[model samples]
Each structure stands twice: as C-alpha cells, then as structure tokens.
Target: MSSIIHILQTQGGEIWSALGQHISISLISLFIAAIIAIPLAIVLMTHKRIAEVILQITSILQTIPSLALLGILIPMVGIGTVPAIIALVVYAVMPIFQNTYSGLTTIDPDLDEAAEAFGLSRAKKLVKFQIPLAMPMIISGIRIAMVMIIGTATLAALIGAGGLGTYILLGIETNNNALLLIGAILSAVLTLIFSALIKAISKLSLRKMGILFATLIVLFGGFAGYRSIVKPPVNVTIAGKMGSEPEILINMYKELIEEDHPNMKVSLKPNFGGTTFLYKALQSGSIDIYPEFTGTVLQALVKTNQKVSHNPEKTYQVARKLMKKDANMEYLAPMKYQNGYDLAVTQSFAKKYNLKTISDLKKVEHRLHAGFDPDFYQQNDGFPGVKKAYGLDIASAKTMEPSIRYKAIANGKVNLVDGYTTDPEVKEYNLVVLKDDKNHFPPYQGAPLMTEKFAMAHPEVKKTLDKLAGKISESDMQKMNYLVTVKHEKSSKVARDYLEDKGLLK
Candidate 1:
C-alpha cells in the first residue's frame, strides 16, 4: 500500500493527465452512441421488422472481439481516438438501443388509450406519455453502456490513444503491481462516478434533462473549436513497443532530439504496441518514430524469401535496404547490442540434457515443455524458424505473457522459454541461453526507424538520433533493463542517467 501511494505521489501528474484523457474518450463515445441509438430506436418502434434487423446487427457488432475490431478499424480509419471511439460506440449501441426499444414497446396499452382519448398528438404522446414512463429503462441502458465504455476504453492505449491503459500495460510489462492496481482502481472509480451521474440524471424533470444534454453538446462543440484554433502541431511523435528496453530507448530518443532542437514539440508514446502494430502505425502516419530492430525488419516487417546473412553489419545493410525499398521507411544505424531471441533453460535442465546448442534440443525434444509469448509462438522467425532450422519441436508448448514466461521457467512450471538476450531475468533466473550453432537467428541490433518522408524532412533529427548509433552495448542495455524492471527505477530517469554518464547529454 505504501508503494502504491509512493507511485501515485511520484506519478500523480501523469495519472491525472491519463484520467482526463480516459474521461474525454469515454464521454465522447457514450454521447455519440446515445444520440445515434436512442433516436434510431425511437424511429424503429413503428417498424418492428426493421428494429429487429438493426438490433441484430448491433448485437453481431458487439460480438466481434474488441481488439480484432480495433485492428480492423486501423486500416479504414487509422489509429488513436477516432478508431477507439468508433469501436466503443459500436459496442455501446446495442445496449442503449435494445433497452430503449424494449422500454417503449412494453408500455401499458391502457395508458396509450388514455393519451389518445385526451386528443394528444403523436409527438405529445411520445413526449408526455411514453418517454416519461420509460425513463428508468432508458437510463438503465445508458448506464450499462457507460460502464462498458469506461472499462474497455483502456484498450485505446494499445493504438496510441492515451488513457489509464498506459499504466496498466506498462505495469504488466515491467511487473509493477502498484501501477496495475492504480489503473484498475481508477477505472473502477470512474465507473462508479458515471453510474452515480446516470442515477441523478434519471430523476431529473424532462425540461432539466433536455437542458443538460443541450448544454453538453454546446460545450463539446465550443471545446472542439477552441482546440482546433489553440493547439500547436506536434513536430515529432516518437513511440516504442512494449517492454522496459523499448521504453528506455524511446526516452533516450526523446531526450536527444529535444536537446538538439529545443523549439521542436516532441511527444513520446511508450509501450505503444508490438512490432507489427507499430509498423502499421508508422505506415499510416499515426506515429512518426519508434525503436525497431534489424531482425524484426527483415523477418517480420519486410519479409524476404532470400536467406538473411548472420553477420551483424551485413544483416543491418540488408534490412536497411529492404525497408527503404519495400516499405519506404528509413532504418537508422543500429546500436552495438543485439536483443535477439534465444532459447533458455534452467542450469539444472541444461546440465541434465548436455544442452550447449539449439540443435542439442533434439536429444530431449519429447521431454521438453516450452513456454513462449504469443509472438514467438506464432512468428515464422521464432518457433517455426527454430523447428525448420534445427529439426526440434518440444512435445508440449503453451503461450503465455512475456513477463510471466521467466517466472514460469524459474519455478519449473515449464522447462524452456523464448528469452531475449538483453532480458535481465536471464541472469536473475539463472538460465543459460543455448547457442544458435546453425546461425538461424538474425542480428537484432536496435535502432530508430521512421517513414522516408519524415526522415527526409527532418535530416537534423536523424543526425541527432544517429548519435546513439553503436553507443549502447549489450551489457549496458542489460543493466538499464535491470534498473527499470528489477530496481523499479523510472525508464526516463534511467535513460537520462545513462546518457549523462556516457557524456551524450548536455
């Protein structure tokens, strides 16, 4: 509890900023959904068949997995708040529409007859008789939608839409339970607040409720106009994939670039996503720069049928050339370290199997139980490549989160894990990496990657970032990762310290 309080105190500013963003996105999504759904549902009350079809469509939309829906929306609408809101609205629509329709349709027939006998027009009947009676059910639907939107809005972080999910994802990646608790607790609190607001609004007179929604619409419009006129354009937006290493690297990039160009407005989106998501984001112009690796560029980004060279320099050259030609992206000079994948096993397991090379796994393939992250389990350059190059496949394999795989192996829950070379847990868990005797794994030297257009326009930015080329050594990166993941040091502080120690920062 003390640790959580300390984290909140130290990171209070960021937490507030993230909370604001979360509320903004959730409210926008909820408002848009309510406006679209309630009106359409009202109109469809007269057409039962059409209402059923529309409701069925919304139900199907809700059935699509949230992440998959976000992925699909990325290509059409791109990432960030727009796509996030669209996905959230789709999920919100069904509940609001269904409840509103059910509420209106289930009204007492005798009340309708009384309204007609009083000579009330259609509009008067809906406004005076039906709506007030159905207010509870309508409010209930909106409440349910708001709760769902608030909860699922966390996923917006994956696509660079800032929210509490940033803390949650960072926590999971770095094993920080305090950060995780903060995010979850805050989200729950926000849900309660919204629930209370809905309950309050449900008791209001129709005139008062109408005034409130009208006031909200006006405020939203005025804020949008003010933002369009007031906000300055961000010159550079740098992002990083999930993990302590990428977080640190992006921080270094931010510091170096801002130091060189003091007038430039730079933004950092840490733990933006995995390689493929970041790559797609780059292509779509959602993000400008991110730390990437030579092996990932060659194996995942711009896959080639030709054999890749094992030599570091040669691998870098091949990846650089291919990215420029195939994806119209620039691959900056790589650092000295290689954060490549290697199979790891406990010292006892290796000793028992006499495992010195990846090929040696063949001897005990049947007995081996492997734990891998989803990316490694599926990527062609990961498990599949290992199987093809070494003719070894474990008898049992399970996919788990990257952060948990180390613990799984260390606890003997699994005997093998797909481990990164620069991971601090490799040493902490006393695991040995089997050599890639066949040289199947390509060099994974890290570097900043950007689109060609951004690279050409900001040559000075490239020069400043290139200063980091060949700077961070393998041991240096491992130590930095350890500082953040094990010692609980902030990534930005660790990055700044490393740069200061190396005489790179002014």
Candidate 2:
C-alpha cells in the first residue's frame, strides 16, 4: 500500500497531464463526430434505405484495431496528435451516428404530419418537432461515444500523444502493476464522470440551461487555464520508439531545445516496437531522430556483411557511406557505448562442456537449445546468417522477447542465448560470454540517425552529441543500461547526470 502511494506521488504530475490530454482528445473527437454524425443521421432518416449501409460501414471501421489504424495513418499523415485525433473521431462516429439515425427515425410520423398540417414547412417540422423529440436519444448516443472515446484515447499514448496509455504501456514493459492500475482506474473514473454529466444535461429543463452553461464555461475555462499553464505547442511534434534509450534522447532534446528553441516548438510522439519500426518512422518522417546501432543500419538497413571489426573508424565510415547512398540518412557521432551481439551460456553449461568460442560451440551445437527474438529468427542476416557464418546446427530454436531470452539462458532453460554485450544482466547472471573467434556478429556502435534536413537545420546537434564519442566503455554502458532497464531510473535523469559528470553539459 505504501509503495502504491509512493508511485502515485511520483507519477502524479504525469497522471494529471495525461488526464488533460485524454480530455482534449476525447472532447475534440466527440465534437467532430457529433458535427458529422448528427447531420448524417438526419440524412439517413430522410433516406431510410441508406441507413443500414452507413451503419454497417461505420461498424467495419470500429472493428479495425486502433493500433493497426494508427500504423496505416503513419505514412499518410505522419505522427503526433493529428493522426491520433483522426483515428479517435473515426472510432467515435459509429455509436453516435447509429443512435442519431435511430432517434430521428423512431419519432412518431403523426407528430410530423400534425406540424405540416398547421402550415409548417419541412424545415420547420424538422426544427420544431423532430429535432426536439430526438434530443434525448441523440444526447444518449453522444454520451456513449464520450465514454468510448475516453477509453480509446489511451491508445493515443502508443503514438507518443501523451495520455494515460503511456503509464499503462510502461507498466506492462517494466512489470509495474501500480502504474497499470492507476491508468486504468483513472480512465474508468473519467468515463463515468463525463457520461453522468452528459446524461444529467440531457434530462435538464429550459430553466436548467443556466447550469449547463456554467458547466460549459468551467470546462472551457479549465481548458484555457491548462493551455496557458502548460504552454505546449499547437503544431510541433517529436516522435520515437518507447523505451529507455528513445525516452532519454527525446527528453534531452525536449529540455535542451523544445523549451528554449524559439522558432519551432516540440512534443514527444512515441511508438512501441523494434528498430525496424523506428527506421520506418524516420523514413516516413513520423519521427525526427532516434538512437540506432551502427551494425543494425549496416546489416538491416544496408544489407552488409556481418563481420565484427576491431577498428571503429572503418566500421563507421562504411555505415555512413551505406546510409547516405541508400537510406538518405546521416549517422551522427557514435556514443561512448557499444552493444554488440554476444553468444552467452550459463556458467554451469559452459563448465560442463568447456565451451569457449564459436568453434567450440559447433562441436556441441546439436545438443543445445537456442533462443532468439522472433524477428532475429527470421531475418536474412539473423539466425540463418549466424548459422551460415558459424556453421552451427542447434538442436532446438525458440523465439521470445529480448529481455526474457537472457533470463532463459541464465536459468539453464536454454544452453545458448543471443545477448547484447553491453546488457548489464550479463554481468549479474555470471554467464559465459563466448569469444567470437569467427567474428560472426558485427560491431554495433551506438549512433544517432537523422534525416538530411534535420541534420542541416541543427548543425550544432552533432557537436553537442560528440562529447559522448568513445567516452562510454562497455562496462560503463552495461551499468547505465542496468540503471535504466533494471533499476528503473528515469532515462532523462540518467542521461543528464552522465553528461554533466562528463562535463558535457554547458
């Protein structure tokens, strides 16, 4: 219980900010949905045959997964809040539209006849009789949409739009139950409150319009207060993957430039996935910058040979050449850290066979269980490439999350595991990192990859990052990774402290 309270206290600011974002996204989406849906509903009622088709089409959109929809929108609209808002509005349309059509259609035909017989035109009957009578049902539809949008707005966090989903996704990745519970509970509470308020307003009489007006004033006034207080931009956006590395870079950029840079403002737009996704984001302009490994760009992006070289200069030059010629990207100065792939086995397993290198592993390869990431298992330059390069045939192969693969090897569930040389857990688990006698894995020096335009615009950025070049030894990087991936330190704080300690911060 105390831990829960502590978490709440620490995350309270993010929680409140997420709430504001949630409200803004849900309300704006609902307003847009109502504007379109109400008019469409009236038309559908007037043309009864098309009502079924329209509802079915909207239902199809609702069935499409929110995450998938966001991905589809990336290439077309890029990232940030605009795509998120468009997705939410589409999600909101179905419920409101169906209810509105039903509401207007179900009204008594005799009431319309009576209004028309009294010399009232069609527009008059619609305004005075049909619309007023359908108000309750229309409001109910809007209420449902509001509740739905409040819940779905959590997904906006996946695209770095900053909502309650940020906490939930982080919680899932880090195994923090408190964050998940808090995000869920807050979302539910917000939905209930908004739904109840809408319901109450719908039931109110004309004399109660004052109460409704006051509610609107307070709501809009609070929005104004939030806008003034936070002062986040209305247009600028920042996007990257969701994890410690990306988070650290994004936060540093936000602090260093977003707050101080006058011409253009910035906000985070995060996505959850692998390096491939981050690369795709950069290519499509969904993200401005992200941390990427030199070897990954070489092997995955450039389709180069997978041979580790001791000389960092040569490796970087090749990487730079490939990125420029192929991907239209530039590799910034390498960070101090290097995260090369290492073959690891439990100390017990290594001792049993006296395994020391790729050559030694090959002798007993058929007897060992191997685990790798799903993509790593299938990539042309991944498991297949490893086998071809090393000439090893393992008894079994399994795919799992990168973090879990380390634990599997440490616990002896697998005899061999693909590991990052700079992952702190390698030291913690006392595993044997076999020497790459054949050099199957390439040098994976850390570097920032940015578009040509971004690099040109921020020439000083490279100089700012150069302070880290060759500063992070493998041991230091392992410790830093542990601090982030294991000790749960905020990445920005970690990066900033490291930079300040190194006198890189001016």
lDDT of 2 by residue, 178-290 (tens): 66677888899989999888887787664475576668668877976987899855333445554455566555555555334455566665435666656766788777777
Q: Where does candidate 1 stray beyond 4 Å?
A: 351-354
**Residue 489 in model 2: lDDT:** 68
In candidate 2, which residue pairs clash? 160-270, 238-269, 336-472
TM-score of 2: 0.78
Q: Give the distance in Å from residue 396's predicted Cα in candidate 2 to where it truly belongs.
A: 11
What TM-score, computed on C-alpha atoms, does each candidate reach?
Answer: 0.96, 0.78
Candidate 1, position 271, lDDT:
79
